[model samples]
Every structure is written in C-alpha cells, then in structure tokens.
Target: MEYFVHFLLAILLTALSYFVGSRIISDGVAIWQALIIGLSVVSLGALTEALGAPIWFIVLVPFPVGMLLLFLFLHEPLYTWFFTYLITLALYSVFHVIMSYFFSFHSLIPAWRLS
Candidate 1:
C-alpha cells in the first residue's frame, strides 16, 4: 500500500512538474502531452521501486530519462528541455527534502523512524 500510494504521488508530481515547466517556465504544452511525458519518464522509477530496489538507486532513474523524454515529447529545442528539466528536478528535490524533514510516519512505526 505504501508503494502504491508513493507511485500515485509520483505520477501527480510528474504532471505538476511538466505543467510548471512548460506552462510557466516556457511555452505552454497540451495537458495531454504533459501527461504522456510524465508517464514515460516516471515509469522506470516506478518499476524499480515495485521490484524492491534500494531507495538511493531508485532516486537516480528519473533525471536523465525525464530530460530525454522532455526533448522527445516537446517540439522545443534541447536547451529548453534541459533547462526546464533542471527546474523540475530542482523543484522535486526541494519537495522531497522538505517532506522528509517534516514527515514522521514510517512503515506503521512512526517513532521507530526517529531513532
């Protein structure tokens, strides 16, 4: 259940990142296009996680994949895609760090995580 919820959240975050990058940081893309890009980029990480991969290793799959997909999915130049992906990656990192800092839950053992 934890993995399931995490995957859902990751999908939403991917869409949000695409939306922000294309719509706000650069020219707007179709919502459906963003969804496609997000789905393509995050699928590998989702698969790795589902296979019980280490968290640190799972963290590494999405960056280059997302950048590659961004360039492929959008008609924009590579620099635009790269820069926007960096923005998205930075935002994702900040969100993850902030959530980890405040999050107290741990596999149904909340206090166990603190130690």
Candidate 2:
C-alpha cells in the first residue's frame, strides 16, 4: 500500500515537473509524454528497490534512464531535454524532502526498504 501511494505520487510529481521544466526551457511536453516519463522513473525505481539495491544505487540509477526517456519520448533538442531533466530532478528532490520529513514516509525515489 505504501509503495502504491509512492508510485502514484511519483507519477504526479514527474508530470508536474515535466510541465514546469518544459516552461523553463521554452519547450513543450505533451500530457502523455509526461505520464510516460513518470511511469518509466517509478517502474525503474521500484525494480531497483526490489532487487535489494543499495540506497545510493537506487537513487542514482534512475537518472540516466529518465533522461533517455525524455529524449526518446519528446525528441527535443539537447539543451531543452537536458535542462528539463535537470529541473525535473531538482523538483523531485524538493518533493522528496517534503514527503520524507513532513509526511514521515520512505524516500520517494525508492531507496532502502523496510524490513
């Protein structure tokens, strides 16, 4: 159940971040594109967690996958896609902090698991 909530939140966050990032880069991301990126991120994160990956690994592994997804899905130029990826990550970190501290939840990006 917790993982389910986290997955849902991650999808929404990713979509919102895509919107904001697109605006920042003066590029555009379709709604479906944003959702696809979000799904890719969360799915990869969940897979890493299930594999007993270390916290650092879990957090770091998803970055490239997401960036690639952005390029593949949006077909944006380097500057636009790269910056959008960076901005999305930045916002994800902020939301992760909020969710972790305020909500007392596990990390949003899928790190260590509870026993």
Candidate 3:
C-alpha cells in the first residue's frame, strides 16, 4: 500500500545518501557498496518498526548501527561517520520536499510522536 511505497522511497533515498556521502567525503566508499549498505540499514529499520517501536526509535536507533556498518563495510574512518549521517539527513529531506509537492502524504513531517 502507501506505506510500502514510502518504504521503498526511503530505501532509495538511503542509497542516494550513501552515494552522495561517499563521493563528497569518504572517497573510498563505492557506489555499489553504498547501495548494499543503505538497503541493509533501511531493512533493519523496517524490522524494528514492525516490532511496535516508537518513531524516535525508528529514526534514531539505526544510526549507530549504520555508523558501525560503514566502518566495517567501507573501512571508513570514524570522522566520515558524521558526513554519512549528515548526507543521509540532507538527502532524505530533499526527497521529502520533492515528494511533498506531488503527494499529500508527507512522510518526513513527524507524525504520531511518543510525546
């Protein structure tokens, strides 16, 4: 359904983030590898979401795991973790802005918070 569409879009954007981050900062992280890592992280997020986790948990928890994954997978330095996360957020926001123009469904606009 709609959620599935959003999920796929999110994974795609995640891949885009990895591509951007690798190119701009971590020169060693390949596009192919980025696609794999991005897909894996988003998949983990989706799994956690299905377990009744909160929005913050869904948005935030996978970050450290992602950082670890980058280190392990790309042999990237700890410093590049910042750029990786930063690029993900930036690119995700860009994706949201564009999608918002076409669809009323605003996934990036925080909904149903714990508080």
RMSD to true structure for each model, in Å: 4.9, 3.1, 3.8
**Model 2 C-alpha lDDT per residue in residues 1-115, reported as the tens digit of each score:** 9768877887778777776776677656777888887788778877887899887988887778778877776677897777877887788777777777777656465553332
Q: For candidate 1, what is the lDDT?
A: 0.64
Ranking by TM-score: 2, 3, 1
TM-score of 1: 0.70
Comparing candidate 2 with candidate 3, which one achieves the higher lDDT? 2
List clashing residue pairs in candidate 3.
none
lDDT of each: 0.64, 0.74, 0.67
> How high is the lDDT of residue 111 in model 2?
55
- Stretches of model 3 off by over 4 angstroms after superposition: 1-5, 104-115
Mind giving the per-residue lDDT tens digits that candidate 3 earns over 1-115?
9888887776777777667766776565776777777777777788777887987887776677767666776666666766666776677667667667666545443332222
Q: Candidate 1 has which clashing residue pairs, if any?
A: none
Candidate 1, residues 1-115: lDDT per residue as tens digits? Answer: 9866755665666767777777656775677777776676667766776788887666676667767667766678777777777777666555555544676323211122442
TM-score each candidate.
Answer: 0.70, 0.81, 0.71
